[model samples]
Target: MRLLIPYINAMIKLRLETLRLSVSGRITGTVYINLSKVFFPEETWNDFPLTIFNWWSHSFLNGNEGDYRFMDGPFYFKIIKKNGLYFLEGFFDRKLIVSTELDIDEFQCSLIHNIEILLNTIKKNKWDIDANLDIELLNENLCKLKKNI
Candidate 1:
């Protein structure tokens, strides 16, 4: 029994190490995915611009470590587009990362490719930027002040 326990622990460690290596190492950045702006003006339903119907950042990362499922986190947002493409910008982890204006009909495909590349690039490049996560985190409190009209 003792021998098996040690083996199990070793396997778990190895698996975790493998996952870490497979993903970009030390990848910490804010990722922004805009849903409607340039190409999807009519598609922009409700007041939320960046977010689709239920696809909040808190629920976006189904497989990522930051996936909060139902609990709303500070990182989730839906920006208002006044003129140009409503951008989704924030300091993720610590690095400044931005998503291309996502109005392409095939957004699902582009999103996967873009995020994969962005995370890898940030992980490899190790950019030094202001922490935007704090802003998102803080927004949670201020958002309550808005009138429910």
Candidate 2:
């Protein structure tokens, strides 16, 4: 299956492209989503690897609404579920940037794919990346999420 989620009038196409790890263990990567060119960091951000996303995935699975701020900046993403549909919205300084709908299974796949990207990067590099990565917990959560998908 392709990574691109169908971008209809009100649908979101989001994905993460993991670049590399810094000497300090922060993830340097890009978030690929609709209108992401202007908002996300050019190459990567000096941010925790997969930590926010792991939490976001877990919350998305268990809750009806949740919000996440990006790179400690004004950019934020909020997810809300109603009538069996998921609404994904992005905001900057409380001003709405974009809003779109995501499919249930599509979002699950997005989480699984993102987790795999981070986990595989660590595995392939064979770096002592766990000091800040918390890999064991990520792997555990990944397994549980995979079973659901």
Candidate 3:
């Protein structure tokens, strides 16, 4: 999948810092966001049709900030928008984890790319997505964001 609008060369990337064994169709790995200012981040997980990434796609794609808290039990992050940029102030289990910022459009592109890569990873691993609601929503968001791009 590709973005409908050409990306504006943002200095942000989402890489699989580490990958582990698959369990129940979920690819467990570190969804590392390589950006300019994010520090002490701990964004890893099961690539199941879960809430984390889907919620992220929903929030940023619609130009809205998100507050995510689900993973390692208390994984949390809040995306704040300011001056045409987005800031993330987050924590894992009550300990501050992610604190960072990036351009708004770039942030949306990053989010769209995350879903695209995760979906690719899912397909590569031969995980089933016949009825996964999270995958469905993610795909919808991906397409929607791409079209407006």
The candidate maximizing lDDT is 2
User: What TM-score does candidate 2 reach?
Assistant: 0.72
Residue pairs in collision within model 2 = none
Q: Any runs in candidate 2 off by more than 4 Å, and if so which?
A: 1-18, 35-47, 130-133
Q: Assess candidate 1 and give its lDDT.
A: 0.27
Model 1 lDDT per residue over 1-87, tens place: 001011010000001111122142222322323333221111221221112212332232332112211122333222223364332
Alpha carbon lDDT of each predicted model: 0.27, 0.59, 0.57
Cα lDDT of model 2 by residue, 23-141, tens digit: 77666555533433332322334445466666666666566278755555566677777787776766667776666666657666766777787778777877676454467767877
Q: What is the lDDT of residue 59 in candidate 2?
A: 69
For model 3, name the residue pairs that clash: 5-149
Ranking by lDDT: 2, 3, 1
